[model samples]
Target: MNNPDSLTNHFLIAMPNLADENFARSVTLICEHSEEGCMGIVINRLTDLHLCDIFDQLGITPDKASHANDVVYLGGPVQSNRGFVLHEPLGKWESTLSVTDRFGVSTSRDILEAIAENRGPEKFIVALGYAGWGVGQLEREITENSWLSGPANQDIIFNLPLEQRWKAAAQLVGVDLTTLSSEAGHA
Candidate 1:
């Protein structure tokens, strides 16, 4: 079993039994990784806030009302006050983290402006925070089977609806999450 790249730009779908308050049933997209630790965003955790809510706070009226329903997500337990966008590469920005060949992260405000203007990346999800692990903490969790990792499917990341992402990612690995049990001590 080879160790997964800390910066693999993939998704970690929590197993059904993952009761951790921070990541249960969450889908995290790895952003940056090194021997020191790892950082990522939870793609499926929708927040009570919406893009319009942020736009209002910024004094920017959206060009159209179509974005009114956009839901901001609680990306992770870290940096809950910050905003980050994990999106498809549509237009370049001053700050962007290429998680994988297909996924990228842009934290700069310009991207958000573009989104408010109705001209942002083709596909994106707005998140309020991000998930992080210190040094070997992630490796320990994986060894303990708290999560099931796999290559990210672009469609699942961008196209699938929120509630379905977990099962969709699980299916990518050919396991039915519903059949997964939380008992780790079982043989």
Candidate 2:
């Protein structure tokens, strides 16, 4: 059985051998983990799209101060067209999943509207889609050495430059991924 409490509010750093193109070199923020399943957003994969593109498509006039030019992220492979906003200073939003005292994920238009008007959370990252795992799936992956997870650090998620988040998240567990060998070792 998977330990439901073990993964919530953690960062899942993809192992070097995890060759899936979608997740390679990815750093995922595990927002929820339960017997039911797991869900997360890839914190480091910037897509070609920008926040302004999303706002324009949705007919929301983004505030100039809202960092509308920031690159949008490819959160994960699931529900690629949906938007998930990870933000700090968690507050009430139309549809939000409070991940921790300092972070939350919002999936509602109202929050987007608030952001467009510069009334949303102090810091936010807009992403499309999310990574999901069925019951026991993530635990199995961990046991297989497919990922290295540790407590999520807001600095990596909210402050680090996009190109550095993957390495920084791995370093949270004292790992320097560059030094890791792709093949599993036999003791």
Best by TM-score: 2
Please report, in order, the local distance difference test score of every candidate based on alpha carbons: 0.83, 0.91
Per-residue lDDT of candidate 1, residues 83-184 (tens digit): 898888735787888776566888888988888887888889889989999988888899899888887777987889989999999888898998877777
Off by over 4 Å in 1: 1-4, 185-187
| Candidate 2: tens digits of C-alpha lDDT, residues 1-187 | 5465668899999998999999999999999998789999999998899988999999999877886888899999999999999999888888999888778999999988888888988889999999999999998999899999999999888898989998998988999999999878878
Q: TM-scores across all candidates?
A: 0.91, 0.94
Q: Candidate 2 local accuracy as lDDT? A: 0.91
> What does the lDDT read for residue 54 in candidate 1?
84
Model 2 deviation from the true structure expressed as Cα RMSD, one decimal place: 2.0
Residue runs of model 2 more than 4 Å from their true location after superposition: 1-4
